[model samples]
Target chain A: MSEDDAVAGPTDDGQLVRVEGFLVRLDLAYEPDGHLWVAPPDGSTGNVRIGLDPLGVETTGTVAHLVVGSVGTRVRRGEPLGSLEAEKFVGPLVAPLTGVIRAVNPALATPRQVVEDPYGTWVAEVLPEAWEEESAQLVRGADRLPAWFADEVRRFRLEGVLAQ
Target chain B: MGPEALLETPARPGSRGSRRAGRTLGTLRVLDFGAVSPVRSQSLWHALACGVGRGSPAALALCRPAQPYVSLGYHRPLADLDLGTCRRRGLPVLRRLVGGGTVYLDPRQLFFQVVVPPDAVPAARSQAVAELLGPARAAFEAAGLPADFDQGELAVAGRKVCGHGAGLVGGAVVVVGNLLERFDAAAAAGVLWAPDAESRRRLAGRMAECVGPDPTWPVDAQAFAEGLVSAYAEAFGVTPEPGGLTPFEERVARRFDRLLGSPAFLCGPGGQSETQLTERRRAEIWTVKVRAGVVEARVVLDSTVLRAALVGGRLRDVVVEDPEGDQDPGVATALEGVTEGSPALEALARGGPSAARAAAAAARLLARARGGGE
Candidate 1:
């Protein structure tokens, strides 16, 4: 779909804010570097799924491909999980939680999965070893996301990286 | 990149977030492997880069690629290059683990590699690139060239004199750059994978324009190596200890040699259909030169619509060419929300929660259309 017609659909699982035609998830915690967001550990699995928020995806432009680590690979928080090569920028997909990879999403088989529903397409599901410690380093929930996301949008716009 | 991308600004010294690591590891080891064939030279640096670790001696390498070769970045696609042309031209295609665009390597350019502890490098990529290339920039200036480090490049009068790459290896960082006495611009540009000769000419012309002019021939490679050594030594506060590769390094380099030389590695993931990124698509750019000010932006875009103007750094004015009555109202509202008094353009980069992403994207085109930035 052309990017102009690719607005975010109504989000059912989380609180959504409509920004400039894109639906941004505000309920999840975002990492400091801006590309990653972590949902708090779900009760049954206690695994936090990591994904990209809409604003970050917008700035990165169209992702041509994704290179991610396989399952069971132990990853450190803040280290690179994989590199995303896109038309506009090439950068690392940083991990949010420090732990073993319990699962990786199958949707990312196509690069378009990322463009379609950035927040919905989790790259990896990590079983965080220390949620209290790691989540403390994250900006969680609606209270923190608005300012952070807005600031990021502003930063990206001035950085001249926003996709046209 | 357009002509505005060539405008060189003075380096903001010390802004590159990295300072002299100032760690004295007793002595710096100079691994002056004078010359190797194209493929081996690349492998040699890869081996040394991976060998860098905590307390590892600051190892420096100087070498020349004995023949011409085109090296691709680790994740870049092979489809971006015309390998048939490369084979016909006898330029072996190779890949580097470092990430970036592809480049041409030949015997005339002197290669320099400096490996240091990763902690000594800044966490920010831009800062680290600035900090690590700082020494090389100093060397070029000391050599009586009017040089400065801009981004990851060392520039002389706005043309690139040095191109560089950096990566983490075994908990250390190895930063590399080239000292060029000459470059074959036509040949360098000619190898790109373009369908038509005209496209190649346009691209090659741009690439040649970006590179600094060739230096005088009969250049002193040894003296140039000395300049790099002195700069690196002073940066890290270590003494130079002349040495060759030990048995272990040789063994390691041998492994890298085979691994890097294999057809699978050379072809890389881009060559394989399973791992290939998108085939290259040229953007269709149309510029609308409005008075609103923002300058110099280079983007490999997914959009064919980029209306850029070269203006000084102030983001003021909006021309929403919405002939269609159906264009979203949020876009106009978002543009109107930018307050008059802000320290910089970044302050206007965002809109309220209800703003559309299209507004931001359009504003980016507007901001860049007017040539102004920090």
Candidate 2:
């Protein structure tokens, strides 16, 4: 499919794009290196929800357990938000933006929902402290996302993470 | 902290090592610490991993524990192990920063840990584990074991020889595995919390079949370390240089030594909360993973008790008992070879109500082992 065809326009809820069978939400800004997404602020709370992107969930294997940072803890960009343990692998979940954790998802107790619905299952909600500065480092916008995402799929495939 | 501060040994004037000093760019530092205390064997590598962004070189660490101990994965539930038994046996239980289930460790196993900057490996966690463990597999093969890397574990002829765990610690990616010269299956099974003697015996039997190297193969610890260093040096396109821990790494190690020994860390993320304890008491079902795709479980419901072993998603060696001391031999025979969640399990209902209840409970136990339910 052409890049334009791969990306669908924004819906009433959000915009989504399909790249190499992996879903990418264009409305959310992403920390490309960490494979995490930050949703726009909630209407009333001004808190942004953060979660693993689809590619992140796929690459990490089936997440068996999760330990998210407790509510009210402050984190700097690139700092550990928490850790995730898959069947064969384990690693940290990095903060996508500088923020204080306003709340942690209850779904972490049983991580099946997080693995099954990466985009929909937010891991934590944060009140971002420096969105204007840090958001520039993130990947967003329809014009930029498709190419970056396609490149990522190609890279993971080359690295033997995805099927050839 | 300059690059010199990170050097294991200070470069001296007119010394033969002088020209090759100062970070030794493109060189893999080899830290060969002979046998160490059980806790140091783990904390040393963790310290190096934490130093990745702070000028720690790409390195390999080799050591064996001077004493036997039991280790739990970072996220594993503390209830998986029987602390009372461990204490009675004088075995120290530790929790590692890496991920995997609980494992029994001792001096017979030689540990090799590779720590590198995260960018040096694939961003994909599975791919990273496989790539990092490639050299260990090679080392095993060089020892004439015909080792294979299957899904992040090293096995010989379908029996696992190397149990591996990997994770990102600080700015570094660390993958740790062991070359098992010998494994005491009964001792390994002793640390786990089993419901009774029969279930523990079954677990021991399964562990003997799945883990450890073939006893006939002789493993020389020095030769294995040399082979590992050579393989890693070749893979990373770097020369091997003998080194020691940097000052920064020493501080980190000291800090980790205390943290890893603390009660809070040993309890891990799955510490026994009151709710979990109550739920476990209510369910009275426990499952322990024997290895990849193998699980042994014990379930107690009402007056009935069931002990089962599941290998490769198929039931095996099922034993059921009731208060009346009566168990239909047909229940065991009928469930034999049945895959988990098969309609055949429900078909046991035709045998009798008690048989049906046992079959249903067995199915749930299998489901829990498969990570489908709690």
Candidate 3:
């Protein structure tokens, strides 16, 4: 994707909010501390997809390699679902919600896809064990997302992750 | 405090999380283990990092390995290093719970580790890395080396003087770096899995040019350690307090030491087999970053292999070899000094099919080296 495609703002449906050139999808629930977004569960499969937000990809210099949890493996919120090795940094992929991993993304084969199109490239699909209780802890809704996302962008900028 | 006072202090049970939230301590704990076994050099700080929590004070641990070893990053594939070469040389290949590429370490280098609570540094990885390495740069400067920390690397005169790795380990942020009094470029290159002897030689030459400190400047290990401690104390605005490992940290270190050397851990998460690694070597462009802006790559094309050294995105010492035992000297000469992202393909088209193929492969290899995929 081109730089223009990456920085494209929210759609007319009012799902995304543009924060400092990064499109923050308000429709998805977020684990702000972990910089992960949780898509609403599929009605048929009842599995929620999880991915790193644009901000997370931006902070991690270059996505060298990604090791995601195997399918059927159980994980807890704040525990390592996997690990990401970037150019200068390495860290865990903290699970946003407790659940069993249903599937791992084929995008792991090309980590740059995750960097280029974060929203489109989901990291893993999880069969959330406590959607009602655990998802409540996530930051969601259009009402709260914009301001929170804007603040996050500002925080990253102040922290030198983004250009001032 | 003195060594006697530090050793006399009893280990506090469950004191890892004893500090109150948001409270900054006035002292930086200094654990200076002069020289230790390769595993202990890594495990000591790792244990401290794992034990850090909300109220935990930042600690700086300094040590050097008594023997040489190859340390791989936490998520790095074991295939990155030539395990047989390491084993034959009696060099233990250990993996550290940190992020960075594979490295060959020996007694000539002094290691400095900083373990702090997550909140102590910036949230952004790059920013945090730079902040953590600031004191190391200061220490090098105080030692009369014109050092600067740029893009998360400490360099002297454009050559990387210190190797660094950082990661969020458990409840703490850990940054580990080495003060290179000397670096064995040949040994460093030898440990890497290269497809051929020529490719390994090219890698070693590039490493010799791009990495390590200035040979002329003499570095006193004791003075450098003291400088690093003082630098950290000043940077954090805290007093240096001599301290030894708590019993809890010691136990964790022992566990880590065992984990670091285990065969399962050495294989890494993917359990990359030799067959898979061989396939990857055949199918992909093998590249290693000597330092920022300098890379060495070997690209294997059908019936031909192209090895090139890239300095600042421009090709240098380009070599093309065919399986029929023929070396394309003309193509190698013509391709020299070609910049990446340029029309190298069209330029080499006149040299025939094999040259054109080699140019295309070189371009892709260069792109991969620069972190820009083809």
Candidate 4:
């Protein structure tokens, strides 16, 4: 199928641009802020995944610890999630999609293990039964976050929190 | 007036000569309930949770714990903790409802809780969280402690005396943290179940980096809490009515009874079975290979060792391969469980996992490096 057909929106195909890198789109959802979705393109195996848009990593800085759940565990879309340890924050790991956890990176059990190899330390994998259902609520591949990420960053800046 | 002389209780409404023309924007009441025991931190947290849960504006005075402990955010992993150290030291470990990094607490510290209605201060983002730390710093000044808002942690001369974390519930912003009087640095390092010698080294290095040089002042918890209450009243422009718990607060406490007393929340949730991968897994699995330029570390794990590595970061890269096994039996023996402790994992995380392990492989390694090798 044509790339345009697979994608939900318009493309820059007119330029015939061919970027050299692998890309895997992911649909994400989380709790505390309520339900939302996003399909982020796959980055590297060890590079940090940022929440530039809403559904990305919200807090700034390298991860200090990442504890994911067991594989085959059935998770709801916006459940209590897992846990993430940043330099200054330790937050819960909410589910991005409701599905069976396919895998969790064992490397993350170590402190700052994810920061050392964020891409390599993929926290967990889930085979969502309703990827379409969840993705429909999320921002498309190239769209900005519907939620106020920039505003939140600005608030953090005003409070003297530097972005890492 | 001196910098410390800046603290003065605000005048009550309708009693001041130049009473500013204003209706109650909101009743900004502060509470100086005085010192209880170290256990009061959670009691105060519950009181604040009630106000926050119901979206009420409030603040409280708090104190640091006498014994040291490790606190995790709600839903954090027990595996992240080094249970052996906690067991050895008899230190308590608990999980908090707010979101933030793990923190160590002791008697030398002072704590404060701010429960404001949602949007009390406009941006409720990470930076905003730091802004909230402003009152805490002011409180330190009020109490005659050299404290300031430095990054996310509170510092006195580049060393952190206070660290804070916050969360919102039912439209109430609850921010909490403490000031340090004393810390058991040795015990603090002992909390992690380091997977290997190298990782332990990195952990120690990081702790030292963050801790920096210690302070020279004596920390008084009671005096500190009082000072913070005065500071909060000044910064938020409110009058603190030294008082007891309100009915709503009491109601919420009863509602959250399990939360306050549960072991799961207090000690962090127990690790899942998979989180405790066995030593066989640690021995057989091909772990991540690390090349630190100066050295290299290759680790293999079985299920048991894998679980240990999962608990902490040390052993993930601890197995050594000496091409010439006869090169040095003494050194090899020393490196046997190089990454088996907390400090080792910390060291490996900061420095190279291999280099740290190699350095600790034997007294000969240290001796040779120091020009005293056999």
Output the number of the lDDT-best candidate. Answer: 3
Expressed as tens digits, the lDDT of each residue in B27-105 for candidate 2 is: 6889988899988998899888877646677989999999999988877777777678899999988888788888999
- Please provide TM-scores, in order, for all candidate models, with all chains considered together: 0.61, 0.88, 0.89, 0.57
Candidates arranged by DockQ, highest first: 2, 3, 4, 1
Q: Which is better, 2 or 4, measured by DockQ?
A: 2
Q: Write the per-residue lDDT of candidate 4 for residues B1-374, one digit (tens) a residue.
A: 11001101110111111122222225455654444443455555655555654545566645455556676654344554567677777766665656555455665555667766444543324543665667777666655567755555667665666667765432345677766566545455557545565555545544543452364565556666667777677766777766556787766544444453355445443245244434323533212211110112223321112111211223222334444232333333334344334354345335444334444442222222222000
Q: Looking at model 4, give its docking quality level.
A: incorrect
Q: In candidate 1, what are the lDDT values of residues B1-374, reduced to their tens digit?
A: 11111111101111111223444456778988887988678777766654655245668888988888998766656765777789899888877655456778888788888776544654334555566778776677655565765433577655677766655543456677788767777787677665455445544554555574444524455667778889888987878888877665667677777766577766654245334324333422222111112222222233212122223432323323333224445444444434333232243235432232334444555443332111
Residue A52 alpha-carbon offset, candidate 1, angstroms: 6.9
lDDT winner between candidates 1 and 3: 3
Model 3 segments beyond 4 Å from truth? A1-17, A158-161, B1-23, B273-276, B323-328, B370-374
- Against the true chain A, what TM-score does chain A of candidate 1 give? 0.83
Chain B TM for prediction 2: 0.88
C-alpha lDDT of residue B353 in model 3: 78
Best by DockQ: 2
Chain A of candidate 2 compared with the true chain A, TM-score: 0.90
Tell me the DockQ of each model, to 2 decimals.
Answer: 0.05, 0.40, 0.34, 0.10
Tens-place lDDT digits, model 3, residues A1-164: 34334344667877876766778998899887767899999999999999988877887668877777679989887666777766556666778899999999986777898898999999999999999999999889887887777777766565555787
lDDT of 1 by residue, A50-116 (tens): 8877765665555655666667878777665665644312345666778988887877656677777
